[model samples]
Target: MKRTNCKIAFNDKLLMLFAIPLLSFIIPIVFFGCRLNRQPYFNVARFFSTFIIIVLLWMVNRYILIWCRKRYPRFSDVRKRLLIQISTMLLVTLLGNNLLHYILTETIFTENPVSVFDTDHLITSNAAAMFCLIMIIGIYESIYFMHELRSSVQETENLKRENLAAQLNALRTQVNPHFLFNNLNTLISLIPENPDHAVDFVQQLSKVYRHILEVKDEKSIPLKDELDVLHAYTFLMKTRFDKNLEVNVDVPAEKLQKRIVPLSLQILMENAIKHNIVSSDKPLQINVFTDNGSLVVSNNLQMKKQVNESTGIGLNNIRNRYKMLSDAPVKVTESETNFTVSIPLIEQ
Candidate 1:
């Protein structure tokens, strides 16, 4: 951190190489021109002394400004940090002005031994210098703010990309070769014994895939659409397991109109099935309902002796997408008898 402070302010190298040194030379020439003399004349000694003081003063304020920026980088912290910065700059400016006055008094009076007392002229020049530097500080702050805003936006975009990738991976798992092989095996058995049921199974499987493709590009969709797709997906699942799997969706019609991340319910259902045992003796039960402004998904605890391979992104992907979309949270909890997920249903 100490080494960081020694670097050029805000990583803008031109500030040190150009702006500060150039201003140091120009400020005194423009403000204190010939005030010590009754007539206009160049005072090399006075110019050099004032330039050094201005350079030191500007550097100190610049350091303080950068330090304050680092300590309070967020936009919410802007007011508190700006107050600290401005107050510190005020103190530095006053002390610098006194040093400048003393240097000018020594160098100019020595150069011209018969000059009259011109304290008022010198004091007025110092006041103007202070105000001008404050304006310069304001300009630097604007640049810092713009840079911070850009960085924040970039971070959000990166998170969105990650969320989409996770969603794609979950979809891929649904349509992967192993899942296709098992369902096709079931279809082959059903076709000979129950042709009509086999046809319905094929249609439901197609609906599941169609819904996945349709919602791939969407950030979120109505819970109504999600449940429509969930029913299609569950049809395929129940055909595979028969009485071994039971899913109860009890959400109110009004709750279905709310929005959720695309395919969120499907992902949660997949997670529950992968981790739990589904058998004739101890059938798996999954419940979907609305509770306290959230969409609740829960399942009974019936752990499998050997769990299937998982991508581990289902819940995390929903959470990340919701963070980008709303202030609401996705909550997960596990107890002695059940595992539950409560996802906020967004209103806006």
Candidate 2:
């Protein structure tokens, strides 16, 4: 079984509770004899005396820690807990040693035994050394706990951010279906008069929708992939407008190999079409070109007077998605005659 499974058996409390006292008693008894003059049976008596002291000390330590935890439930501040633990350990050790010494010296150790209290100087010096050892252990435990707590908090925050991003992406994906539906309705209206054009239009429409579905699982797609979708979309528009729709693409093939947020170009194209008019007399001349490491999509502004349902969500969604990846802002240039959108190209 795993070490974590063993820890769980004790409800996550430290397993040192059993081992510490046993080791503490064994070490002192083996090293230090009961009688300083080295009499017979000194080792045996010392072993039993040390064992009793170890058991009592362990009980006192556990009780004190449990009491402190219960009293101050929100006492999670590492520094504060360290101070309390250090203070309690010193107090307990001093009291325990003195109580053990008094009991053994007065009752059990009436014959040849170890000295309970040496003198004024020795008692003070021994107490200081014991206090220092306890404080060091407490500080180490506090630092360890503090580091673990910080890591746990950071992991929780990262998970939350990921969940929020996934929800936002799902909402953005929904916009593509609405755009496809509108374009399909327009193609249906023109199918009777121009059957051949409509057939070509349906083929281009299929390519565009297929691209969207293929890239849906991707957070970002190569610039080349996005341009392929854009080309398909423009082909459908050409089928609808014939020679009247003038579309130009001047992006570098090298730069097109880089990555960009999926459907970014398509959304901008849809926005341009939705807000402007396309006709023979004043034909929609839309341009896609790169300038200064950025892709620029610009078109002549011929605004439609008729207002449509404005969710005001598409541009904001695109902006938000880009923000998650980089610091570069989506630049929008608007005038009486033209509307241009400049999007930064991201390295894969």
Query: Highest TM-score: which candidate?
Result: 1
Tens-digit lDDT string for candidate 2 (1-348): 335322112232354555544544544434433344554344555556555665576557655665555455442454576578669877877777677866865688556444555575236434533643464355434554565567657855664465355444534644456766766776887789878878877888788768766776665789998898889988877766767677899988789787787777877776777677877787888899998878899999998888566534456666666665556788889999999988888888
Pairs in steric clash, model 2: none
lDDT of 2: 0.66
* Cα lDDT of model 1 by residue, 1-348, tens digit: 323232123555555567665665665556656544555454566566556666777778878887887787666688998899899898878877676666666666466432234676657656756765776677777776676677769969987787779768867877799889988998998999999999999998899888888888888899999999999889989999999999999998888779998889998998888899999999999999999999999999989888767776678788888887777789999999999999999874
Q: Which ten residues in a row have the lowest lDDT in candidate 1?
A: 1-10
The TM-scores, one per candidate, come to: 0.63, 0.48
Global fold similarity of model 1 (TM-score): 0.63
Q: Show pairs that collide, candidate 1.
A: none
lDDT of each candidate versus the true structure: 0.79, 0.66
Q: Tell me how far the alpha carbon of residue 170 in candidate 2 is from the true structure, in angstroms, after superposition.
A: 9.3
